[model samples]
Target: MAQPLEPAERRPANHGPKVAARNRDALIVAAREIYATHGLDAPLSAIARRAGVGQGVLYRHFPDRTAVAIAVLEENVRQVEQAAAAEDAAFADVLGVLTWHLTESAAFLGLLHANGATGHTEALAHALVLSGRVESALRRLLPEGHRLSAPDGLMLAVAMVSGAVGGPTREVREHRAVAAWRLLGVEVGPVRPFEG
Candidate 1:
């Protein structure tokens, strides 16, 4: 005969804030991988499955694809911020960080452009907020004798990277992004490997 199941109270609590946080984090990671592999328009259900969570969990954390995209962008910005936090961080190093992110996660840039084209203020506003943080960091990172102001530098970097790296493959994108940086007279150093 099979053993009886443990009483409900005897078992550990399975649902709570901790589980919710884990589910949300998993969804973000899965969303990043899925979007990178399948493009931003991939199905949301696929993200849920890839995250090993239910659709309900994903919906609870992120109501829509745009919300998911914004979460990914937030994480990307955090990476850039960390790069800039290094004591000897050079503008080229920071540019390398930005270029790596844009190359690895083109969906972030694509979603930003798409939202801007559609006049979706939430995504654009959030992007601008993140951009301000990066620009503030750039104020310190800007190399002496650099012609562009921090704001202009950040804007140009994003624009050039996005425009130049629209290739169908990762290798092509990285190559183009590097070339774009060179074209702008920025000597981007090696990009740090992504930690997340």
Candidate 2:
């Protein structure tokens, strides 16, 4: 038999920051997909497997499910900010972006709601920040004189859109978006069929 290798030879040296960054990104993407599909109660092992990393890597990056949830929420908020910041973006555009994200993020949203019901302070705070950010973005799209009532209108519109069954069909989303615009006193005609 051949001689056995030393311990240092058997295992490669750690790449340090690069490996950690890769693992962190993988975990975030995997968490978003799994949470979108299976909600927050999905096992940590599932996220690790989906990310092609071990539990140790996941824990090193995020100590618990709440940390993972917060990271996902932060990424989602970043996307909303980017979409809302487009040049001359209108209220309808912001509504459409919010509706699309909220519909796609049903499981995450449900988890937040459940956590809020249980008085999870961090989860509740994150939810408020999300709402406030969206409202602020929408307010920026309104005319100078119409900014005063934007918050109430935005909250109502978000409530109406987010309460739909199965997160609302595409047609229903379009309808609700128009309704939200109307509620905000912005005149928008019915959605026309796509002609291609």
Candidate 3:
């Protein structure tokens, strides 16, 4: 699958920052392009052209660069949360999602951590809720001790994998992920028998 365009920052000479919902999709696409090209330093004019809108329209939907960036970050988080709802998710499935996120979003992750949101980081906040629900469901599916431990264990496992590696490619990432899973007391793959 092709990678989605990342969101960029834009601050033209306006303050309208609230376009119609119809224009939001286009603006978001353009913002991703601008951000991909220039990181946080992308210009509003470029994004406007990409979205086929004016400076007023850009600001209409996004008051400032930070707001635009945050919106994009939220969108990305929404995508991640969606993936977390798979019916066939396994222990490795959890690692796969975390692995994908770490590499694809190291930069945005830092930005999000630094920017405090009272209740506006809806994507992540939604994630907290989703996680609780998923854990509740899985608690019935896992082993005894593994039951109560899942909620926190799953979250911590992701953190461990993320911390151990700085988002390596899938092949390398899977290896680290499997190792972390073992460290968390969940063994994956067939064990090699040895004669002592």
Candidate 4:
């Protein structure tokens, strides 16, 4: 007699709220790595592969590349807020956090300014919230004479750092950020060593 046939094991559906949230987090992390290595135009499939999820899961969470980028930016802003909230954190420390993100994810800021960019308003609005917080910190920490007089000063600082992302290497980018602070008449004590 022939051997009996066995039933195939069934997998759980990837549809619950917990599963959705976990998949979204994984996608964001994977997107950050993929975009950093290959720039924003890198294939969305690559991100799904990196996250070990299916294409359907990726689209279910992000819907598009810009959505993934915005999630990454939102995470970056959380880090900035955490750093800013520290009791001993200085304006320079906050900028250090920003520089770290800039070097690691160079193309993120560019997405905000790209011509015909889909998420310009959303990204800029999110960035402006951070800008307001940074401006408050700048006013609190900067010397009277060195303080930026205009309302948009920190946005200018951000623009400077945004410009820095085009440098050849992470070190060059960090140096450019420091140079940007110097141009703004603020001194960042030392460039934080790159860990990425």
Candidate 5:
């Protein structure tokens, strides 16, 4: 997507920083809700409408839809980081976090998927980072490098949990990841969502 950075001068000079911040925040929020519900194909004008702003205002704030999608994905990353930090959770829970993100992070998914044909490099990066978090957790959960390569096992786990939904559902992928961890010799308990 074409990115247009805001002219640094347009900010602060207008709302003295605080209101500018509010406006930017509002745009991101509006974009998030829209992206979540409608996927990434919702128009900038629609987001502007949701935010009670003009199209020009939306463009002024976000530059383009990819920028908005990036912001949403970034927030998702931040949330995943926070979830990983939760002391109450098990190491295996990172898969849970990742699964939740994949299932629920629709705006990030939709927008990126919509741009799939052109090889949306940015959205692809976002997905990789999100998936990497799970991979890291799986790495720690497993013993050595052995379990990490269990792609077939992972696919089986997906087929079972999601009925082979053919898309990433958190439970399935995370189960597969943990199974790889097991293949690595970690011995994770049976992933509950697939307890059959």
Candidate 6:
């Protein structure tokens, strides 16, 4: 028979702040990988194991699966916020970056969308706040005298980008970005692929 693992061997090293921080970051990274591959329904224990942390550490960082999902969405929102606030950022660039992040986060987004209608009020509220932040950023980046409202334009862009998430080609993504711009009444030139 195989030897049973020791308690210390099964859990992450509890060295200090550095170790704690590392464990936290690892959890997020592992959560992203697991969710991307196995989807939102993947077990929390799988996430802890993937992070090389025990269930205790995972619970200390995120009390529940919803908390973990929210943290991931928050990180995604932060990246878009930073890009949107750039001094020389163009609408196409913002759209491209948002699309890239959304594509990578499609599973999480799907979970939030499903939760929104199934009585997960906290998650739904967080999703709305994040969406509002993106919409506000888009409004700030819009050229003067734009026709579509920011919310309307953002919805169209989000829908288009979400649909293109599984696309295999850069051309497809760029094409969707261009279409999004057109929906907002802007005739943007060719869109460059997002570096992130």
Quantify all predictions' global Cα lDDT against the true fold: 0.79, 0.67, 0.54, 0.71, 0.55, 0.70
| Descending-lDDT candidate ranking | 1, 4, 6, 2, 5, 3
The residue-by-residue lDDT of candidate 6 on 70-112, one tens digit each, is: 8877877777778778787786677667766665565665655
Ranked by TM-score from best down, the candidates are: 1, 4, 6, 2, 5, 3
Per-residue CA lDDT of model 5 for 1-196, tens digit only, reads 9989778976545444456666676777788767656667777877778876668766776777778777667655566566555665454554455444444554454333444564467776775665455454444443344443465544244223322212344445445455544444434443432111
TM-score of 2: 0.70
Instruction: For candidate 4, give the lDDT of residue 189.
Output: 49
Residue pairs in steric clash, candidate 1?
none
Q: Roughly what TM-score does model 5 have, to 2 decimal places?
A: 0.54
Q: What's model 6's lDDT at 156? A: 67
Name the regions of candidate 2 deviating beyond 4 angstroms. 1-13, 143-150, 165-196
TM-score of 3: 0.48
- Residue clash pairs of candidate 2: none
TM-score of each candidate structure, all chains considered together: 0.82, 0.70, 0.48, 0.72, 0.54, 0.72
Per-residue lDDT tens digits for candidate 3, residues 1-196, read 9977655554354333454665787887677556644654578778788888888888878887767766665555454444445565454444344454444444344343333453346445544554455445434444566622655775565556555543434346456656766677664432111111
Highest-TM-score candidate: 1
The weakest ten consecutive residues by lDDT in model 1 span 111-120
Cα lDDT over the full model 1: 0.79
Worst 10 residues of 2 by lDDT: 187-196
lDDT value, residue 35 of candidate 3 = 63
lDDT digits (tens) for residues 1-196 of candidate 2: 9988878867868787778888888898798778767777789999999999889999998988888887777766666677668775555555566666665555565655564675456766887787787677767766566533544765665665565414334455456656655665655332432111
lDDT of 4 at 24: 85
The C-alpha stretches of model 5 lying farther than 4 A from their native spots are 1-16, 52-57, 92-96, 110-119, 137-196
